[model samples]
Target: MDDLTAPTGREEALRAMPHPDGTAPRALVLGATGYLGGRLVPRLLGGGYSVRVLARDAQRVAAFDWGSRVDVVEGDATDEAAMGEAVRDVDVLYYLVHSMGAGKGFEAADRAAATTVAAAAAAASVGRIVYLGGLHPDGVPLSPHLRSRVEVGRILLDSGVPTLVLQAGVVIGSGSASFEMVRHLTEVLPYMPAPKWVRNRIQPIAVRDVLHYLLGAARVSADISQAVDIGGPDVLRYGQMMNGYALEAGLRQRAIAALPVLTPRLASHWVNLVTPIPRRVAMPLVESLQNECIVKDSAIDALIPPPEGGRTPYRTAVGLALRRAEVDEIETSWQDADVLGVPSDPLPNDPEWAGQVVFTDVRTAHTSASQESLWRVIQGIGGERGWYSNPLLWAIRGWMDKLVGGVGLRRGRRHRDRLLVGDAVDFWRVEAIEPGSLLRLRAEMRVPGKAWLELRARPDADGSRYDQRAVFFPLGLAGRLYWLAVLPFHGFIFAGMARSITAAAEAADAQAGTG
Candidate 1:
């Protein structure tokens, strides 16, 4: 049994691990931009492993706080040549890539991706492969999503590489797909008319506990090549899990009635109507609830000791997730992935004039405050702190968006004071951010047209020049009419907003100077 943690010294670990050049035990994370992968890189770094991340868009991954710490390789997992380059000089490969949210044929895509990465790891002679997979009970029929996870795990194990697969049920955490589904359902509905599958039992695991197991796997001996089942201390039905969340969220007890006629397809539609999660991601998740996912085997307990405080109870996990959401401290969100209909690149500067119409309201102001102070005020715009202009108008608009199945203002910003490229701020996603210079946001509200708001600040002799612009590309007559209707309000909102932001920045600067 080769000791996974024998080389405790950072310098010694580099030499001991199989690396082309002598460095630390290099760990290459394939899906570093995803929810779990985003959190895992920082932990691996803390555990003394040199980390490198591979992403399709390096700029997207670069927005993460830990991005600067790890070496980033820009490439897609499906590309063999890119995988070969990424796999080289790596001791452990964390295969966290999946395509469940990628619409149809994702199962085939997932299988192909797993095979490609497994072959790459074997070719690179990687010492170990660590994978996080979904839990499915044996002898029970698995959903397409769960089956794909199982197949991927099998592919890695059979690749002649020592693979440690950790199979977990619904991961309870802020921004996790499973937890968000639970959070939205519990928060929005007082009486849930759910499918009969709500009765199915599940063993949910806290994200913290799951991260612990992932990190622990890296320290285990290479002799351990089997799959491990991980779960929280509580085994509960899906409905009961929702009840637990409700209690932790301080919401009144929700009444859930299971309807046999309500199929998974129908339930997914219902989820889409009530939650921010789209139907494509919701359908596969709803389908998987039909099968019981409680952990049957607990063999991993001996291999990796539980965290110091022990496994998180289901209720405790829900509370922690809710707290993180309340404080807007979420590290990663399922929304961090690409939204299907939104533009992948930044909004175009010039409008398409092929019989298309765009309305723009651009305003500029000169503020006698530093660029840093203005940016600080601009970045803190959306959450509990109201938008600087008209609080009542913003509230009314959010309520209307919520009525139309939009995220509204409740999703809030990830952090109160800081703005990240992918962070959700109210109903707008932070599309781009240039520190102390510019911030652009794309509207997620249910609208008849595409819209954006851009803010720019630059240092000037007096202080700084602040500019704000609102751009809308109307789809048709309805979009044009909608813009016309909102034009008067924009004049009021945009003007007042500029004045308010400048005032706030100057006040803060005055207080700082006096103090």
Candidate 2:
């Protein structure tokens, strides 16, 4: 190759310009508490870069699994002083923060934060700045969220510092709002209606591949200071994506019909009612799908090379996500417990149902059986062992769930007598389990709200105490109605189940004594 086409020594050498004193290149990550940032920190650390994060609450950052491994600067991103403090002595700056809300003015908020960080990075003379932006078709009207993301990329690129903006579409992974929408919508509705955007072409990328490009961006050639589009190997319609997820999740291929009149607002409300994702997060995600979002060129491959085995195929990505969701032990990792559509702090208590409304039923029973027996009965509560209630009632509910395309009772248990953090038993996923004290199951059945069942076994002076609770967090008026309509059966189902459990334990004790 000619000298002009050949790579320069400077390009080949890892320039520690930001830390010319020979120390490791320092990376400053904003939005460390957000989804992508939380995943990227460890990747950067593993890539041999020292990591620092600027968070409004240092404790929240510390709460992550990789928290203690890096330095945390407590500050808000919009504050100039705070941004400046965070940018000081940083080599590469990563901007992964963005906001999506149901209300107005989020655009202005995003613009301001981006401007502040860009100015800070420029002033600090950081080696390079890396920004994660959304992929959108050019010259087309964009959703407010996508528009703001593109604007933020412009702000960072124009900051007088070399910037590598990696634009990605619909990141597929657990905990991603986009992926969660797909997961819940497919799991809840077998026949999806309306939304012409469902047919728009979308190039979805996996989270692992996104992180690969992001990590490479920290050292992308200083000469490249433009946005590079990245995506998976295949481009599929939004409907195709949903059905792909269904195939991996072992559900029937979803039948989706595009209704011309279904607007994003109305669609989001429908999503809220049918899925665990609330309207607030679902609205922006739905709107972003209104236009085609695909990679524009091969520029990204030139700069960051495809992930190790090449970019993940859409179906392969879906399968990996389903498998990963089964057993991620880290509290902040991608294992999406079906408790909520996506992760947000649990709604705080308030008098009104304006936002959060939780309904619960409690039943207790006392018996002359040891706690061990009671726990054995409690832990083995579902799938063939039975729900400890009327078998007819359990079968009816299971059929009802199956009719709505929910997981139903068919999944059963992974082990006859063993339960783990993410094991699935019938229509419930084991959320939490304490050896002999409590077994909590999160409902995966199609419902208007979130639901959980707790079976507790405690030792009493005489023998053992068995307590059972059914908790439901209603989504809206529909969710409220769902709870009310089913309230009458609680006495027969829940109360009897609690009593039956303790009785069975006592029967075991009596039978053992007879032996």
Give the per-residue lDDT of model 2 (tens digit) for 1-515: 21111123322233333455657888999877666777778767756688899976564565456878998888766899988889988889998877665257778888999989988898999889999998999998998889999999999999999999898989887656677678888998889895999889999998777877787787777888999898998999999999999989989998999999999988877775565455565677788889998888898867876655567788887776666556532223222222223232332334554555689898888889999989988887786788877788887887777554454564456446766555567777766678899887877777998788888999898998988888789888999999999998888899889888999999988888899
In terms of lDDT, model 1 sits at: 0.81
What's the C-alpha lDDT at position 383 in model 1?
A: 76
Q: Candidate 2, TM-score vs. the true structure?
A: 0.66
Off by over 4 Å in 1: 1-23, 220-224, 250-252, 323-328, 339-343, 347-360, 368-370, 386-409, 442-451, 460-463, 471-496, 503-515
In candidate 2 the C-alpha lDDT for residue 462 amounts to 95
What residue pairs clash in candidate 2, if any at all? none
| TM-scores for every predicted model | 0.82, 0.66
Tens digits of per-residue lDDT, candidate 1, 9-57, equal 4223222333456557888997787778888787788667889888876
Give the deviation of candidate 2 from the true structure as CA RMSD. Answer: 8.8
